[model samples]
Target: MIITHDLTKRYGRTVAVDSVELEVREGDRYGLLGPNGSGKTTLVRMLLGLVFATRGEIEVLGQPVPKRIQDVLPSIGALVEGPGAYPHLSGRVNLTLFDAAGAGGRRKDRRQRVGDALERVGLAGIDRRPVRNYSLGMRQRLGLAGALLRQPKLLILDEPTNGLDPRGIREIRDLLDELNREGTTVFLSSHLLAEIDAFCTRVGVMDRGRLVLQEDLSSLRAPTGRVTVGSPTPERVVALLDGRVEHRDGEVLTVRHDDPGALNAELVAAGVTVTAIATERRTLEQVVLDATTTSSDRVEAAG
Candidate 1:
C-alpha cells in the first residue's frame, strides 16, 4: 500500500536520503533497519508529507504524498520519534482530545474508540493517570493507542520498541502480528535487529542515506548449518578442505557448508580422528549482520 520511486531528500547540500526506491505490498509487514543517522526518520517523514523530498515520487494508500497528503493521511496512523503526549493530561483525556481532533467517529463513538484503544494497548485501568506519571513503556503504549484512534489502514511506526521492557516488547510484537493478520499493513522502522527479526516479514537495510539491501526475512534467514569437529589436529582437518573451514576455536574446528555428508566424508578421509561432531543453524541476527557487512563492503568498493 506504499510505494516510492527514486525518493531523494536533502537538507541544503547534505543528502539525507538518496534515490530510495521502496514498495510495501498490501498486508505486508515491512521493517526498515538502519543505524543512527542513517536517514530512516527522514525517509519516513517524506512519506508522511511532514518533509518534502528533493526529488522523486511517493505514494501512500494509492495517493501521491504532499499533493494529496491530507486526503490520504486519514487512512494512515503513525508514531514517529516518540509518542506525542501532554504530560499534564491524564491518558484518557489525552486520547479523548485526539479523538476530537481526528475525523473518525461521533463524540460518544470516539469515547468508545478511545476506551477500546486503551484496552488494546493494555492501559484500560490506568487511563485516568497523568501521562507524566506513566513509565516509558506505558507512554509508548499510549502513543500506539493514539495512532489506533484513527483506525488506520496502514500503520507506520518508528522505533516503537525504543523504551519498552521485554514484556512490553512482546506485547507490542504480538499486537502488530495480530494487526497484520487482520490485514493492516505495518511499516516499521527499528534499530533492534531482534525485534525486526521477530516481527517483520520483509526488511530493507539502509546505510549512509542509501538503501543497501532489501529482502524477505524468510529468504534472508534460510538455514545454513555449521558443523564443529573436535580433533587432535584441527589445522590439518581444515587443510583437507579447500577453504570451507571457517575457524579453529580451542580444540574444535568450526566449518560451514550446506552439505553435511560431504563434510563428514572429507573429515574422515583426512584421518583427523574426530572426537565430537555438532551442527548449528544461523540465527536471524547473524544473517542480518552478514548481509549488512556484505552490503557495506560492496558500497565501499563501488565508491
Candidate 2:
C-alpha cells in the first residue's frame, strides 16, 4: 500500500531522511520504529505530501506522491503528529465540522460514521463534551475517530500510543488489529516496542536518518534461548562449553545458543549439577536496541 525508493529530504545541508526505502503491503500492520530525530516523522510527512522530498520517489496506494497526492490522499487517513481538534468545539462538532469542511461524507452518513468511529475508539458517550475537557488519551482517540471517518484504505499513525493508559493502549491495538484483519493497511510509528511486538507483523528500524533494518517480526524473533545455570563452581560449566559462555553473574553462568538440549546434556556430562536452569528470550526492545546501536556504530565507522 506504500512504497518508497531512496526517499530523501534535506533542509539546506541537514538531511532529514537519507535515501530511505520502505514498502508496506496491503493488510499489513507495519511498525516504523526509531528514536527521536531518527527521520521517522520526516518520512511520514513526505509520504503525506506535507513536506516535499529533495530526491527519490514515494508512492502511496499506487499513486506517486506530491504529483498525485490530492488524488491519493483522499484514500488515506493520517494523524501525523496528533489531532487538530478545536479546543472550544465539542468532540462531535469537531468531527462534524471537519466532515463538512473537507467534504468528507454526506451529512447523515457523516453523523453515523462519526458516531461509529467515536464508539470504536471508545469515545461515544463523551461526544458532546468539548475537546478541552478531554484527557490526552481522549484527544488521541478523537484524532483516530476523525481519521477513520473517511474509511480510508490506509491509515498512517505516528506515536499513536502516546499518552494512552494501558487500557486505552489495548483498546487501540485491538481496533487496529480488527482493521487490518478486515483488509485495511495500517502504518504505525511509535517508540513503544512492546505494543509493536504485540500487533505489528513486520518492523523497520531506523537510526541516523536511515532505515537500518526491516524484517518480518516472526523471523526476527526466531526462538533462541538463554540458559543461566547456578552452581558453586561456574567455571567448570563455562569450561565445559568450550569458551561459549557469555558471562558469569556471581554463581550463575549465562550461555546463549539456539540449542538448549545440547547445552543441558553438556552440563550434565561435565558433572556440574545445575541448581537453577532458567531460560531467557530476547524481547522486542532488546532486538531494537541492538539493531539501532549496531547501525549507529556502522554509521560512525563509515564517517
Candidate 3:
C-alpha cells in the first residue's frame, strides 16, 4: 500500500532521511524499527506528506504523495508523535468535534461513529469527565479511538503503546491483529523490538538515516543448525551424540543438529531420557543488533 524510491530529506546540511526505499504491501502488518535520532519519524512524516522530501518519489495507496495526497488520505488513519485532544472537553465531545472537522463522513452517523471508536479503544461507557482528568494511558486510548473513528483501510502509527500497562499493550495488540485479519494494512514505527517481534509480519530496520534491513519476521527468525536438549542422563546424551554436542551445562545440552524431532527420537531410542528438545533460532534482538549500530542518542567524547 506504500512505496518509496530513494526518498530523502535534508535540513540545510543535516540529512534526516537518506535514500530510503520502503515497501509496505497491502494487508501487511509492517513494523519500522529504529533508535532515537535514526529519522524514523521524519520518514513517516514524509510518507504522509506532512514533511516534504528533498528528492526521490513517494506513492501511498497508488497516489503520488503531496501531489495527490488528498485523494488517498481519507482512507488512512494515523497516530503520529502522540495524539492531540482538547483537554477541557470530555473524551466523547472531543471525538465528536474531530469527526465533524474531518472530510466526508455523514453528519447523521457521527454519533454512532464516535461511540464505536470509544468502544474499540476500551473506553466504552466512559463518563463525561473532561480529558484533563484522564490518566496518560486513558489519553493514549482516546487518541487511538480518534484514529479508528473512520474504520480506515491503512493505519500508520508511531509509538502506539507508549503510556499503557502490559494489559493495555496486549489489548491494543489484539485490536491491531483483528484489524489486520479484517484486511487493514498496518504500518507502525516503534523502538520496542519485542513488540514488533510479537505483532508484525514484516520488519524494517533503520540506522544513521538509512534503511538498513527489511524482511519477513518469519524468515529473519529462521532456525540455527542447532538444538537445545534437556535430559536427565546428560552423560549418555553426550556420549551418544559425541562430536555433535557442542556445549553442555548440567542437564542442558546444545547440540549441532538440524532437526530437533529426529534428535529427540534418536535419544529416546538409545535409552537416553530426554526431558525436552527444541531447535534454536536466531532471536529478533540479535538480528536487529547485527543490522544496526549503537543508538544515535549515545555520544562518546574523543580520547
Which structure among the candidates has the greatest lDDT? Answer: 3
Clashes by residue pair, model 2? none
What digit string (tens of lDDT, one per residue) describes model 1 on residues 77-170?
A: 8999889889999999998888788745677687789989999999999998999999988988999998888788899999998888999899
Alpha-carbon deviation at 104 in model 1, angstroms:
3.0
Q: Over the stretch 186-289, how does candidate 2's per-residue lDDT look in tens digits? A: 99998778888999999998887899889888778756566767888887887778877788988887887666677777788878887777666667887888
The C-alpha lDDT values of all candidates are 0.85, 0.85, 0.91
Predictions ranked by lDDT, top down?
Answer: 3, 2, 1
The CA lDDT at 239 in model 2 is 74
Q: What TM-score should be assigned to candidate 3?
A: 0.95
- C-alpha RMSD in Å of predicted model 3 compared with the true structure: 1.5
Question: Model 2: residues >4 Å from true position, as ranges?
Answer: 223-244, 248-253, 265-282, 293-303
> Please, what are the lDDT tens digits per residue for candidate 3 over residues 189-233?
999998998999999999989999999999998999999999999
The count of residue-pair clashes in candidate 3 stands at 0
* Alpha-carbon deviation at 255 in model 3, angstroms: 1.1
RMSD of each: 4.8, 4.1, 1.5
Instruction: Evaluate model 2: give its TM-score.
Output: 0.85
